[model samples]
Target: MKALISTGGQGPDFEKVKDIFTHVNLVVAADSGLNRLVEWGIEPDFLVGDGDSIDTENVATKKYSYNPAPRDKDFSDTELAIIKCLEKGADEIILIGGGEGRLDHTLSNVGMVKKYAQISLWMTSKEIITILSPGNFITHHLPQTQLSIFPLDDHSGPVKTRGLVWELEHIDLNQSMSLSNRCVDSEINWEITQGRFLLLATYE
Candidate 1:
């Protein structure tokens, strides 16, 4: 199953986010992230978080599975939300979050995607971050978007890319450092034979 988790950060333009709704089987709101959904008039299937960032008085009134954790818990609201998604048998997760707010949260959210292969994509307010795990991915998002593809982990080697100005091929070393590459075609493809890497596509 595919799950969509929303975090309390800057939100993407609703018009640009319409396509993702058609692909998700589950929708989740992480703590105050519900506020963003409320703004968009989108209700989530599950609301998981510490219930501290938003108005707690109205939480119970919402018709959804509200799993509230202690505010002093070890996990973050976003992490808790992902755990909830995994418990529901979600094989793929698309995290909807913004790049604004706490910087640690932003980095940690991106780290979760890099650490866990189940997270295929993270659609932020500013960019579309794709985590590739040694396979092929084709995205038809934002033609000519400022794209930067690189291997976050050095072990990620032997990667191939198509439809980018600077395609990764016939390169030496264990990791790649290709940046400032734009989508040559409306549909862009990326493939890696081994290890993992991440691709950042700006919403420009």
Candidate 2:
């Protein structure tokens, strides 16, 4: 089954989550995100986090809770939610409502990508997807949208990109060599030959 994971930040676009839930079998809320889910009148199946951000009593009466300690040995709230969903047999995760708050939390949410190699989708209404890995990936884009690719690891190898306005031919992308190219058509493709890369595809 697929799972939709929400973070403990400002809520995501209702339409975005609505579109995703149609394909997923489960919904998970990370901390205060449970309140956002309730505010939107959407029911989540699981709640995983430290419980400091939301009322455990509310979660208990409405959904299954997996509360961890504030000083837990591992995993952020988003990470915990993703882990819980995976434990429940979810093969895919759709993460939303993750980037609208603090910079540290936003960075932490992105860091969660390095931990999971499975198929995952992240959206914030404004940004359609921001993915990571060392494999070929293709996504549709509206004309004029921008797609940026940067090596996630230090001194990564060459990354080949196709179907973009400024295509790269096995060009090395690093902290300084990240590529931000505009989409030329409805489709864009990329292949990472070396280290992990973050593909931030978005439209303004």
Candidate 3:
């Protein structure tokens, strides 16, 4: 199943979330994320959080099911939402509102994608970010969108790409290298020979 997870950080544009809402099998909210959905006049299938950042009365009016967690816990509210999605057999998860907030929280949320590497996961704000495991991956984006690739660990070996302004042919990537490149074509094809990396695409 495909899951859409809204987190309690800086939310993405309403249009962006709405565009994919119809494609998801499930929608979940984490804490203040409920507030975001309420503002958008949309209700999620399930809500997961500690009930700390949301108005209890407002939530009571919503008919959606909720899973309250302890205020003090090992995981963040977003993580809890992810766990719920996974428990419900979600093979793919799209995380919204996970970026552009508390630096630590944003980092933690990004780390979650790495932890759940077995599943296809994405985090989006002004930019869409995903971890690319070793294999061929294809993506489509508008022309002129900025595309960047970075090694998640010490180094990634022999990365190859096409459809970008600066195409790569089996080139090594490391933390120090930031390919602030752009897509000349709508279709992007990439392959990683070894190791994993983060792929980011955003409007310039």
Candidate 4:
């Protein structure tokens, strides 16, 4: 199943986000994310959070399955929402409203993508962020879109790419050697022999 988890970060453009809702199998809210949905006049299928940031009076009128976690739990509300998606057999998880928040929370959400790299995980705002594991992957983007790649592991070995302003071939990418490149073609291909990397594509 494809699941979309909305977090309590910066609010998203409802017009743009509405399109994504049509494509996903399920929609989940993480605490104040319910507030965002409420603003958009949409109710999520599952609400997973501590209920601390949500407006109780407003949420009480909404009809949805609520899974409340302890406020003092180890996992954040967003993380708990992700677990709920997994429990519901989600193979592809997309996170919305994940950027432009507390720096720590934003960073934690990015880290979550790495932790769940075995599955197809992504986070988006004005840009889409994905962690590419060791494999061959292809991406399609408009020409001149900002595409940046960073090594998630200590070293990404034998990485190869095509259709970018700055292409690579069997290059060892480390933390200090991030690629702030741009897409040059409608289709871009990438392959990594070892280690994981993060790809960020900014929307124009």
Give me the candidate number with maximum TM-score.
4
Q: List TM-score per model, in order.
A: 0.86, 0.83, 0.87, 0.88
Candidates 2 and 4 compared: the better one by lDDT is 4
Pairs of residues clashing in candidate 1: none
- The CA lDDT at 70 in model 3 is 93
What local lDDT score does residue 52 receive in model 4, on the 0 to 100 scale?
93
* Clash counts for all predictions: 0, 0, 0, 0
Model 1 alpha-carbon miss at residue 204, Å: 3.2
Per-residue lDDT over 1-204 for candidate 2, one digit per residue giving the tens place of the 0 to 100 score: 888887776645786567777788889888887887787778888777788888656666774656555756577888888888889998888887766668998778767766675546777645666565667887677887888776666666777777788887745466455446888887877677677766777646
**Global lDDT of each model?**
0.80, 0.73, 0.79, 0.79
Give the alpha carbon lDDT tens digit for every residue of 1-204 in model 1: 999988888867888787888889999999988887777778899998888887665475688877578999988888898889999999999888757788888778867876667898888888888776777777776678888766656577787778877777776426446677788788877678887666788887
Count clashing pairs, candidate 3: 0
Model 2: worst 10 consecutive residues (lDDT sum): 170-179
